[model samples]
Target chain A: MVAKRTVSEVGEFGLIGRFTEGRVQPVSTLLGPGDDAAVVAAPDGRVAASTDVLVAGVHFRLDWSTPEQVGRKAAAVNLADVAAMGAVPTALLVGLGCPPDLPADVAEQVAAGLWAEASRVGAGVVGGDVVSAPALVVSVTVLGDLRGRAPVTRAGASAGEVLALAGRTGWAAAGLALLAAGRETPPGPVAAQRVPEPPYRAGPAAAEAGATAMIDISDGLLADLGHIAEASGVGLDVRSSALPVPPELAEAAAELGADAVSWLLTGGEDHALAATFPADAALPDGWRVIGRATPGAAVTVDGEPYAGPAGWTHFT
Target chain B: MVAKRTVSEVGEFGLIGRFTEGRVQPVSTLLGPGDDAAVVAAPDGRVAASTDVLVAGVHFRLDWSTPEQVGRKAAAVNLADVAAMGAVPTALLVGLGCPPDLPADVAEQVAAGLWAEASRVGAGVVGGDVVSAPALVVSVTVLGDLRGRAPVTRAGASAGEVLALAGRTGWAAAGLALLAAGRETPPGPVAAQRVPEPPYRAGPAAAEAGATAMIDISDGLLADLGHIAEASGVGLDVRSSALPVPPELAEAAAELGADAVSWLLTGGEDHALAATFPADAALPDGWRVIGRATPGAAVTVDGEPYAGPAGWTHFT
Candidate 1:
């Protein structure tokens, strides 16, 4: 049998060809890979953009998560950021740093996963660069179209607005807890942790329904809402009883002797959308009312300050 | 005296605030940093985008270049890619991975350099993410507007066209050679290696002048021209006598026992724009004709194959 090839053996240009040769591009991709730069359509006269970087040991472990999973997470985080702005993602540009000794197949699998997630929302993998580094570092930049709608920012919330959430929270945190405890019997939480299913369409739907403010829950609910509260100059109060904690999380917490509610409050990386709407506005499908924007500057759980760890802070 | 503070001491949000608090954004930045994502104007209904990843020890050595210079190089490279596509850069999004122990001042200096370079072109530093990593990695994504001109792609070159160049070459490579030889007497070459001054306006000028094909000479004159030859299915021949070998390059070459002509033909990273124009077309200002496109495939110097190293490949 032939020896397995490393990225060094395939070379940079060859590896780029492998990643882009047969991929299909969406209509928004005016020009795809294999050029000095890629051209993407932004028909609304504006483009929404965001960037995120992930490192190997700090953000993920190769032994615990597959390269494909890591790639999906990278794309998901940036895509969710664009969606949080009430935009439809149009294209993704990746800047990947890899060790020379990494298997070619592993790098290709990572590209495959990026394409998979981008294609899920009709976005194209437009362009990328790969270079040798000390460890794996994935940097993704996503571009989106506002479609003639005003972007929903975190500073639009007002006091007396109803707080709402769309999509699951705390499941990824529970998965991390299970993994840290070295018990992975329940597959749902672990799967959620690997590849988040962000509510991509809910952001625009909420925008059309008159969402005043919005954010994606990459940090814990309290910490992320704290951002909204700080930016909008309004306080927020969450009713703990209204949070939907999946049964799997409760079961895993029971086995681990951990509080599921704490995970729901402080765990991050679930990529759920949270927003505030006028008290009289209709809540969109898949969204449920959970709290209200208050008159002071603080994030409270049942009108009391939360005492658990706040949220993730990189480099800390 | 106050002790030095590391990035970990500043925290992610604190560091982001430090980088963004005092910066001024251009008109293209509809919404600047502080929200989940930034919105930028795309007046022509399409945006040109490119990404490049620069890693410590691979693309740069901290001991050889200042953090500020490294940051400039990172932004310059991606900006050059957008310029090569005949577009005007509008915004930049950075993805930075830094070691936890890195001094906060150094990171601030890096941000300062990025802003300095972007502001030169009227582009805004729209958004970014910073995370903990084993080594420093700067991933920059630059977005540009086409201004309604069709992009000058590599595949448009035709036989019987005049080949031209619009910026400096071989200077950065000579500086690298000087640094490798442990001599710093000539400051010009060393400075060129530290930061490149790409002829950014020349790209759009060439497009407006009806350039048939164009590429930035990031991988040396011969190697980058080879890309155009392959894409456009033509042969390229450079006249050795017409190449401009600057006096400083000749002096550096004589002292280092290297051939100055070879450096002019094969040195990379000057970010000069090389393009093909119709034989009867009036070439744009700052551009000089140096070669011709032929009726077959191959890149030649003095009508023969180049025998030295062609260019760079990251993994190899």
Candidate 2:
């Protein structure tokens, strides 16, 4: 823990000076932070955008997650949405809220995490705002480039299409469980909770390969699949026998006496990409076919209705 | 007040459906909400961005402001920043944090307010996140287009330049003072506080006229100009004798026994446009010559130090 630095210690202007100093904007950003607004080149003539807000205690526990981890997650989640649209991320805008008593370093670490993750997806942060609040809150909005490719949406999936996933799953959920259990140390699942490793390039790859529909699994796999089904007006059937589970997740589930299948089926926050394609489509690297789109508006596991929790639902 | 319908009643997906239905995208936005991210056109090959956050108690009091008012104010402040950049606003992404107990109609009204104001600016509310929080927090990120014009910044103001303002000044401050005083009925200043009318087109006008630099007066006129002076490393002197004082502001200042000059000179949130131009530059419409730029780095009034409060500081 660090001693808190009063916000007035570095005046609002002074804090802005610290946050913005020496940062280089991508060539696409014609104007950045110092101005009223930042100007970025949208060369493809179209831009993609999404926004998310992560609140303290609700989105992450300060006691369990470092500010840096929170920052990375904040930026990464929005970046995943950009990628989900099959777009090249170009610029980001962040709005941060914190108590005036919060340490300056915490703010800096958050910015660092945001920058690091944004850079991973080849994007730049162009502008931001810092305001006083009762609790720490980080809100991020990402703008992206479609690069002349048509956007892949959740409503485009069709009957007889193959459902594939191009990233890991259940790790964040496992990590959340570990944290809930009061584990003093970071285990594989707990570590997964800190920072998700989304497969960034797979989204564009799926789009290039003519994906019929696409979505990112921020909710549990089943819940996300249901979103595709509802949007595409079809049914989805997951083959539980073919489910992929991380070895660490399996071990952790065994120790906790929890069903690994439950986590694999319903855990979320791994930001894995899921898309439906024609039967003849070629799968991209890292993609695993876990299910198939069917004619009826229902979901099943191994062709049967496996009894378990449906998935994540907002407001419990 | 109407009966409050719990947000949980509509559910997150239901609320999204209510907000996004019937929304029209400009030719610029190829994809709108319901997709992972929206696609909008930036034909000029550049995009301008800015973000701001408003807390329930800090930025606006729910008791004094309707949810719709809060939404309009939230959008206005950010859009003003984009206008300050001499860019035409294109899209906005909103992130809202509210308690589960709040009314869904309140949220919808907020969104409607957001849409109304964005519509006024000829922009779309492209995408957003809705999450539960302890209090209401609105985060808005604005994306704008340069329209092939170069961006105007605060740094280009130099010595031997005339400083002028285009639009109302001190009204919002007087408005705030009136609101704080709690008159039985709404006063002119209070109305100004509720909704500020920014000089939206003046930025491009200044840029087109070869103005050296420009900024919007979100803070007091002196303080914001101080930014331009500090950024340009020059001095600015405001001529109080030539300043424009709206009668509404004058009456409120007189009623409150406060110095009207101080309010007009150092007050903020008027969203007025301030800029410096060459000695012989032609000022734009609704503009008044109020000062000049000099060789040193400081802000003054009528060639002397204005003996009063400096300006608005957020935390204090």
Candidate 3:
């Protein structure tokens, strides 16, 4: 194998060129990279926007995952926010900070990973900035179009509304448990921890199906649901039996002598969409009714307060 | 003075609440913070977008400048990119990563500075994320509306077009010189380096005036202009005598026994707008013609190749 070139050897502009060369932009991109700013078509009267930052060691360890995984995880988290807003993601702006001594190929893998994941949502990388720092920091800001639909915010849930969820939960947390326990777990949970593929389409579907409120589970389910409950001035009563716990998570939890229910309730970063709808509303496919919203501000599991972790807090 | 609370004490969620609580939003904000994502009005069909990252120590030193200055500078730099596209800025999404040990007030000041600078252009802070990191990293992504006008891009310049600038030059570079030389300098240049105030409205004005090509002077005059020349496939012949050299820059150069012309040519972070226009077009009030787009690929000063520094490079 040939030796790889380093970022310091090619410089910032050179690395940028490598990332942008021959890139095919999506139809929403009015003006792509190479300019001071990219022009993206926000056909709707309003544009939904969100941002997230991932730092090395704190967010992800470079040794455990590839740069590609890191890139995909960053893009997925940001896109998940747009989805949670009941919007279709259109574009992304990535701001990458890496040490100069890093291999150019590593940065390329990161950019490639960004493209690969963006293509999953049919969005494109519209603009970015590259800077030198002591460690790798990936910051992604996503833009989405609401398509004339009102945003499904956390404040819209009403008492007596049915609480529902789409996609897997607690899998990522179980994967984290495995990684922490230093045990060889199944590939499914481990991959879930490394690269989260949020149910992007479920957001728009829930909106079309008349979702009253929605939020992406970046923090644990209990922690995130608590946010919705507080914002909507309602209590979320989650049914412990309704959660779809995958076999891999259960197996991993059993091996680690941990409770899978705790992971299901408090797992964060799964990028699952939790939403509320009218009691009699017809639910869309992949959405499972979990419980109901009640008056007051609390999130309880199985008619009782959850006693496990409150959720992942950036600073504890 | 009372002892200030640290970020770790307040925790990430608490600090976020403090920064967002009771905040005033601009007219363009349809949905502000506290949701899955913020929605901003995009009256025009297209939105110009850009992202930039500023790492502590690499981009700014906390000992030399206040957190407010860093926040303002971050907002200004990102807004300048939107301005460079000849679009009206609409909203900003900030992603902040800092150590948990940082003072809570310092983070608040950073957010406040972002708000202060964003208000200058009538834009609102739509959304953001805060994460824990080893050091402070502020990443800002700005969105802009073209208002039915075509985006001014770097690839539109033509040979024989007049090259003009709408803001001051070399001030930030001069300020950096004073800081590096450990000399006591006036507040003007030092402030310029700390918080750049680019002519934001001038971007739309230049666009209305039919600017053919445009770029922000973040990477020094010669270096950034070189980008326009290379992208437009034209030579830029800058008249050295016509280049704007502020008085403070000259004084600082004299005190340091450095050539002021070098600073004027190669200074970065000034965030000045440079564009190419029809030679016969009536220039706007703040814009001054300092050069002409020529028929070759080289950027010349006074018809000769510049021999000074080629501006900043993130990596060696």
Candidate 4:
């Protein structure tokens, strides 16, 4: 049997060539990898940009996820940020740091995952840098074209607005709970945890449908909505009964002796799009009306403050 | 004295607020930090992008350089990449990872350094992310505006073109050597090592002057020139006598029994701009003739292959 080669053995340039060689780029990528910088088309005269960092153990454990899964998560988080701004993703620049002893295949798989996720949204991996570090660190920066629309910021929601959500929520959190309890019987939630299916088209659709405010639900429904409430100086309330609870999530929660509704309200990482539209505005397809914006500055559930965990936060 | 607050004590949001709050952005920044993503003006209808990652031990040692200097270095390296593409830098998105125990002030200083350097080029720090990790990692992505000019890539040089250089070389290498020898007498070189001064204007200037090929001298003169040579299918030969050996570098080398010319030929991190132009093209101010492109594919010094170490490379 052949021994697996480490990243150190392949060297930085060699590893970079392996990851980028012969990969096809989308039309938006005017100049791809092999240059000092890449040129990406932003025909709307403006560009939306975002960055996200993922660290090994802190963000993902190799034992719990494939290197590819980690890469997909990294790209998904940043791509979702771009979509939340009502923009179409155009290009991605990746910065990868790896331990010397890490297998070269792991790094290649991570790159493949990033490319796969980016391709799904018609974006290209245009440029990147590879270096040595104590642990695996993947940083992704995404660029998007706004196509002549104003950005839907967290500060734009107002009183008398209808709150809506696009895509699934709580499934990732339930999957995490299942994993913690050493049960993987329900592959649905576990798969959601591994790779999120963010409603990418719903973002631009919401913008076209006159969304007043928007944010990707990265830190759970209640916690992320709290951002909109505080930024827009309005009160937000979510109807617990309105949130769709998938049968798989409910089954997993029942088996784990947990509350599915709580997960639906407070669980995160599904990369769902949560947005606010005018009371009279028509919500986009797949978007369900969940609640409304009021005249104060607090986020509530069923007209009362939620009594469970708020969501994910870094550091403490 | 009051105890310094650690990053974990401040929490991720608090740390981010302290670093980004009240900072002024340039006109190109349509939306600054605190949003899911930033909107930056790209009036040229295209954006040039680049990403670079710096690790704590491999890229910078806190003990040898101030946190602010380290941050400046991080920003400079990436900004230089954008400049090398003959584009005007418009914005920066930083992804920072830190140990929980790292001082909050240290992190703020790092952000300040990044802002200072970015501000020098009239660019804005538009967005970023802060996450917890085992060590300090700074990943920066910069966006640039091409202003209707074609990107000056490494693949355009041809035989019979004159090679020219803008900005100093060997200074940073001398500084690193001085520090390694436990002697920092020459403040110039030591400072250069801490924060590189990339000639930001020279890139576009060279492009305007009709440069056939260009590259930022990050991995040293010969090594980087080799990139252009290979990509453009030409050979590059540098005359040793034409390379500048700054007086401070020469004095430091003399004291340390080192070769100043070798540093001039092989030192990196100065981010000097090197380009090949039509033989009769008028050189821009601050750029001096150093070599010429010739037939074949080898990078030579005074018509012979260099026998010393080439330049820096990550991993092995």
Candidate 5:
């Protein structure tokens, strides 16, 4: 029988070597892990960067989500933020804190998840720091390349522009609803919640087509669009009828007696792209027109304000 | 009297707005916060990146150090990593996790501390995320520009090269000993453990002066030098008599009946820079030679293998 090695037993440096060994790094990485710092190609003279923190109990539960799922979701969310800026992800630096008693394989699974998601977009996990802590905390910082194009910010939307969205919106929220209700959910939506697949290609495509402003819908449709509205000094009127509610979400909502539309408007962590474009400008394929930018600052659905909760908040 | 507000009361977005409202961003930032991602100028078509995670009760204690000290130390350590690569820090991304019960001022103090240290290096805190957790965790990712110079990695030391160091050694460990012994120490050494002042300038100076290899001394002199020796496939013979032991550490060692040389050899968190230069190369200012690289794998002191505790281990 094999003896199970804990993180504390292998030590910090040993664990890092274990995870980094035999891993193939993306070509964009000039230098990979094992150095004090890693060198990655920026290519465009500027690098786009963002960070996110995930706590064990606050952001995820070990019992509900596998270590692999947590790692993949963490990478996906940060990559989504980079994509929202109309940039291609080049590298990621992960900072992880785990309790000493954790099985070494669990940490490896987390690293595997990070590598899997990063490989999907041709990005590399170039460097990271691991330390012992009271609970598990994963912090990811993503670096992206703009490719000499202008970054699509949240403050560029104008009145009379058309608001649009790319990728699924309500799937993750529906999965959350199922988890909260203690009901078993289908594998598709459950995986969607655990590991989001954001439409990364749509971001650069929309930027190429001249998107006025853009944001990743991590904090729900209405709440995230509210950020663009607040930044650009414009209002958004989303048409609820135009929202593409997945059939699974609709069926789940009916079974749970919950409103699927609420999930569409206020469910968070879908990592979908929401943006605005000129009324006459042609939008890239996969982007569905959901609303229009208006002169006022209020975010409304079908011209009336959203009566339910706005979106996810870190603190209650 | 004003009621003390917790992080949850003001909400995550509200707390972020409060901290970032009037903060001045560094000039290297092409785009600052309040967006999906921030853009920092990389200049030489490449970026040097590293990350560090600090957890409460592990890396620091709130009762012993102020939030400002914690923040500054986090930034300083990561900046030291960049400097070890012979690069100048340009930007930082912070990810913070705190319990909802944490006072809002505590979080602000942490951010203030980060901004203060970053400004010293002419870098900006371009982006960050805040989330509620069971403990306070500060994860920092620093980006630096090499300005078209070749990165000084750990694999270049030659057998005939001279091993040298810059900045204070064993000061932080001395301070930790004082703290652990429940004795009062002078503010200088005490502050060293809380907030390190790494010799950032010496890195590029050594690089320009044609140093063979470099590493930040976060994990003690012998241990970090061991990394360089292993990577460069050379042995190091350090001269214990030549080590620069600060006067305060000597005094403290006398009081505790401990050997200051132990701290110098095995103490961690000083964040000094250790490097190797050609035997005949003129030493740069602020650097002192204390050893030489040899042809074998063992690290020794004065031709003898003097082994006390080698260095710190995360999970002993």
Candidate 6:
């Protein structure tokens, strides 16, 4: 039988080595892991950056979500933010907090998630610090490159531009609903909720196609789009009929007695790409035109007040 | 009379706006807050990055230290890591998790600390995310520029190289001991534990001097030096009498029945720069020669085995 090793036995430095060993870094990275900080090539002379923190019992649960899921989601959410800037992710630094009793494999799983998502975005988990916490908390910071393209901002949308989405919405919310139902899962909506596969490439694609304004659908579709509207000083109009409710969402909503339309309009964490393009520009594949940028400050849907849920507000 | 609003009153967006208002961004940053991610100039074709997370009870106590202290400590630690990579500080991304009932002033103080420390390193807090948690946790990610200098790593130390240190050691541990002893008002050593002043410029100076290997003594002088020895496959010999023990540490150690030399050797949080230099190299002004690198895996003092504390180990 193998003797069990505790973190205290090896110490933080030894454990850090165990957690970071075999991790590959990009060629442009001058340093990785074992140094004070990791250096990565940023030849573009600019970097796009963002940070997100996930707390246990709020953002995730140890019982419901595996450590790998928690780690992936923690990293994926931050990467999505960077991608929303119309940049390619280059590197990430992670701050992890967990109880002392937490298994070493759990930490490794979290790292696995971070590694997988980072690889998906053509980036690497370059550097990080791990410490003890009262509860599991994962904090991730992403550094990205614009690759010489203009960054799409929320304040650039002009009147008459087409408001569109390039990724699926309401899928994660539907997954949540399924999870709430306590149904043993398979390849279903709940699974998607566990791991949100963001429309990572669409951000750069939109930048390439001259997208004027952009934001990620983390805080519901209407709410985040509203941010662009307010920042750009423009009005937004959504055709309610244009809402893309995944079939799984309709099924879950029907079973849960929740309105699927509300889920499509206000549910968040789908990581769908929302942006405004010049009316004359060609639309990219998988993108659906859902609305138009107008000359007011309000967000309207289908020329009427179709209120189910507005959006998510922090500290509410 | 206008009533001060709680975070719940205006909600998350309003709080974010308040935090971002009156803040000026650097010219290198193309985009700031209120966006999906912040865009900053990363000239030199590369970016240096590091991250750290500080928990309220474990890392900092609200009763003992102000929120600003927490913020400064949080950002300072990450920035110190970046500085360790022989890079110029550029920008920071922050992730904060707190309870809904946390006062807005507390958040402001934290932000003020973050901004103050960031400015000290010639960088700006470019973007952040605020979320709900059961406890207060601050995570900061810093990005830096190498300015075309090759990063010095721990693996490059060679036999016959002189080991030198560029900052004080054991100050924080002395402060911590004072704090634990109910000596809340320790004259100098106490504050040192609250906020360590790392020798920020020494890293770049070492890089410019073509130092072969480097590390920041965050986890005690001897413990962190052990990292260099293990990484470079060499033995190190430390001199007890050469240690730069602050007068306050010596005074406090006497009262606590501890030896200042042991603390100087094994205490941590000094964030001093330690490096291995060629035998014939000219040493910088601030650096002091404390040891020599030799072929082997052992670390000794004065050509003999020195029985002393081995420094801190996490979860131990």
Best by the lDDT measure: 4
Quote each prediction's TM-score: 0.99, 0.95, 0.98, 0.99, 0.98, 0.95
Give the DockQ-based CAPRI class for model 1.
Answer: high
The digit string of per-residue lDDT tens for model 5 on A9-76 reads 88898889888988999889999998889999999899999999988988888887999999999999
Residue B301 in candidate 6 has what lDDT? 83
- What CA RMSD would you report for each candidate? 1.0, 2.1, 1.2, 1.1, 1.2, 2.3
lDDT of 1 by residue, B153-255 (tens): 8889999999999998898899999989987747878888888888998988999999999998987989999999999999999888778688889889989
Native contacts recovered, each model: 0.91, 0.76, 0.86, 0.91, 0.92, 0.86
lDDT tens readout by residue for model 6, A104-200: 7777788888888788877888888888788878899888888898888999999999999977777777777777778534346776788888888
Better of 2 and 4 by TM-score: 4
Kindly provide the TM-score of model 1 when superposed on the true structure, using C-alpha atoms: 0.99
lDDT of 5 by residue, B1-316 (tens): 9978989898898888977889888778989999999999999999999999999999998988899999999999999999999999999999999889898989989999999999998999999999987889999999999989989999999998999989978889988888778766755677899899999889888888898999999988888988999999999899987886778888888877888989888888989999999999998998999999999887888878777888887887
Q: Using DockQ as the measure, what is the rank order of every candidate, best first?
A: 4, 1, 5, 3, 2, 6
Docking class of 4: high
Where is model 3 more than 4 Å wrong at Cα? A1-3
Candidate 2 runs further than 4 Å off? A184-186, B1-3, B184-186
> A1-316 in candidate 4: lDDT tens per residue?
9999999999999999989987899999999998889999999899999999999988777877899999899899899998999998989999999999999999999999999999999999999999999999999999998889999899999999999999989998998898878887699998888788899888888989999999999889899999999999999999878887889988998899999998899889999999999999988797999999999799998899999889999888
Instruction: Quote the chain B TM-score of every prediction.
Output: 0.98, 0.94, 0.98, 0.98, 0.97, 0.93
Residues B235-295, candidate 6: write the lDDT tens digits: 8898877876667887898889878887888888768889999999988777889989988
* Model 5 C-alpha lDDT versus the unseen true structure: 0.91
lDDT of 3 at B52: 92
| Interface RMSD, per-candidate values to 1 decimal | 0.7, 1.5, 0.9, 0.6, 0.7, 1.9
lDDT of 1 at A304: 98
